[model samples]
Target: MKKEFRSGCPISSTLDVIGDKWSLLIIRDMLIKHKKTFKEISDSDESIAPSILSARLKLLESYKLISKIKIPKNKKENIYLLTEKGIRLTPIIIEFSLWGDTNMREFNKIKDVKGLNLDKSYIIQSVQDHYNSMLLNF
Candidate 1:
């Protein structure tokens, strides 16, 4: 579906495409946690409803952020992978992690967000590289 922006502002436009309760979480599942199947993503800690998961997956696909493929052996199962566009959001996700680790830890009960001591660039590249490697197996 073509996205309708609320304003011409870049941030607003970006939000139009991804600013939702569930969109980024879906992205996070695929990018950070390597969740590919519908069941895997739905079983996340957030416990997103199946209906909302379906809608967010479609929205992400409509924006070219993810691509879906059927398992070769099991045609009934699907694996959702992030596209280049979606992988580009890795840095943003990393930033959010850092922000939450630093600021929201107390209220959120986050004991620690791993790799806080490591270089941000290294972490980002590692995540993107992992995704790229996964692509080669398909």
Candidate 2:
């Protein structure tokens, strides 16, 4: 069984849903690159197993972070899409990607992002604004 999340703090609650390394990576794959199908997710260089990816998708869906829909062209296969909650994570994911590109020898692309001195406050505000826009559009 999955561990229960702490409820009082919103940050804690947010982490409870996606604190795991895989979950965030999955979210990154979806939000950053707009990967939709299970095949695309499984094909990630991260090499996540299908079963683990399935479980993570289920968990994110349960938390209302993402949803799946059948593609009109290929109705048999489902494409996972981020809900408002998932879209709200955009800036944070970008920041983490920026951090990884800077510190990790493997991720060198962030030199530009770091050089730009991406504003953390601006990212946070963007996320809030994006979520607000999503909610209102509904």
Candidate 3:
């Protein structure tokens, strides 16, 4: 579907899709936290409402950032995974993590991104590699 954009600016266009907090959090759960199921994502620290969660998941799927599927044996359950396009947001998530780690500490307690001991590129690559491994197994 062609989406209506408020402006042609890159950042604005990107935000038009993932601008909402729930959408970004949903992506975070899939990418960094490895939460694939509806229950798992809804049970996130943010405690998103079921209705909102369902809507955001559908929106993300519509944007081709994520994909939903059901296992052959369990047609009743749905598993959502980040597509390659979605995986591209890994670096953005990491950037947010790093920014929060540096600037948000005085206001709130936020954990550093996993593998803080390594370089930023390594952390991003490790996350992408882990997700790819899971995809391969699935």
Candidate 4:
């Protein structure tokens, strides 16, 4: 089923492409931790069902947000990685995590989001600056 979005805002449009509960988390797993295998992502706390994980990975690939590359030693297995577009979303995810940290008490235990002690804007800028530095070095 196609997800219905609230509006045509650019952010909303982007979210429409990936706003589902699972997609962002999958992307987050890749962007932050570099998780890159079907098995690794399937084992996340979301504990996504294999069918759903397969479907979501296909959708993300069709949209060009991620690419599945063959693992060097074993060409049979694929490693998922973010495209430039996918890496660019790190700030938005960081911002959402910051908001959740301050306002949504239940999710603090989530990995990587903790220990930063970062404020909303700080995290956003930090992600942006991190991406910027990456671009410079690349």
Candidate 5:
């Protein structure tokens, strides 16, 4: 069940759901790196602990930001995919990336990622396109 917040403020409500560093980082991995599996996500540069990863995954899934799918041929493994609500976070992610790139010296390391053009409109369109394609396949 979704947790109740102190008030109905949008920012506070958003924070209540995904305010933690790990949660957003997990979302970043999925949004930017396209990681879908536990192993893949755990291998991110942040190196989150397995226990913490599991908890955060549960929280994200509970909020309907992501969905866990059992791998057809590998029952022991599950893949995660973003829902429409999650896809809507692309702009915020891009804005954060831009902020990091502008303020931090090491932020440019991943700036050259293919299809991740610095153009805001392009990034938004790319995210929407990817989401639409995934829906079609589903």
Candidate 6:
């Protein structure tokens, strides 16, 4: 169930919906890894618990941020895909990643890390291109 907003502040409202660490990590998995299945999402680097993952998925769906679609070829399997609303979060995710890359010393030292240019328009464009390609394949 969605929580009631405490005030009209935009940030607060946004946080109310997605402030939890796990929620954004789930989004990150979808955006970066293109994971869809429950197993795939829960198997991310962050090692989210199955119960937490299930709850977050429900919340994301309730907020219209993602859609759970059953693959046409498989009756028992469903894949989660970002809605237009969820795709809008790409820029924010890019900014957060850039911040971590820049300020977090440990993150920078990670092996084979390809740094983004920190250009907002370029990042958004790149994400849009990827999203478009995914749509074509879907």
Off by over 4 Å in 4: 1-9, 106-112, 119-138
User: Taking the tens digit of each residue's C-alpha lDDT, what string does model 3 give over 42-119?
Assistant: 998888999999989988999999999996789999999999999999889888888788789899977555576579
lDDT of 6 by residue, 84-107 (tens): 899889888888777776688675
Q: Pick the candidate with the highest TM-score.
A: 1
TM-scores for all predictions: 0.94, 0.73, 0.94, 0.75, 0.84, 0.90
Ranking by lDDT: 1, 3, 6, 5, 4, 2
lDDT of each: 0.90, 0.77, 0.89, 0.77, 0.83, 0.84
Model 5 per-residue lDDT tens digits across residues 51-136: 99999999999999999999889999999988889988888887777667667746445444444445788887787687657656
- The segments of candidate 6 whose C-alpha lies over 4 angstroms from its true place after superposition are 106-112
Which has the better TM-score: candidate 1, or candidate 6? 1
Over 4 Å off in model 2, which ranges?
A: 1-3, 106-138
What is the Å distance of residue 116 in model 3 from its true position?
Answer: 2.3
Model 6, residue 22: distance off in Å is 1.0
Ranking by TM-score: 1, 3, 6, 5, 4, 2
Q: Model 3, residue 114: displacement in angstroms?
A: 3.4
RMSD of each: 1.1, 4.5, 1.4, 4.1, 2.6, 1.9
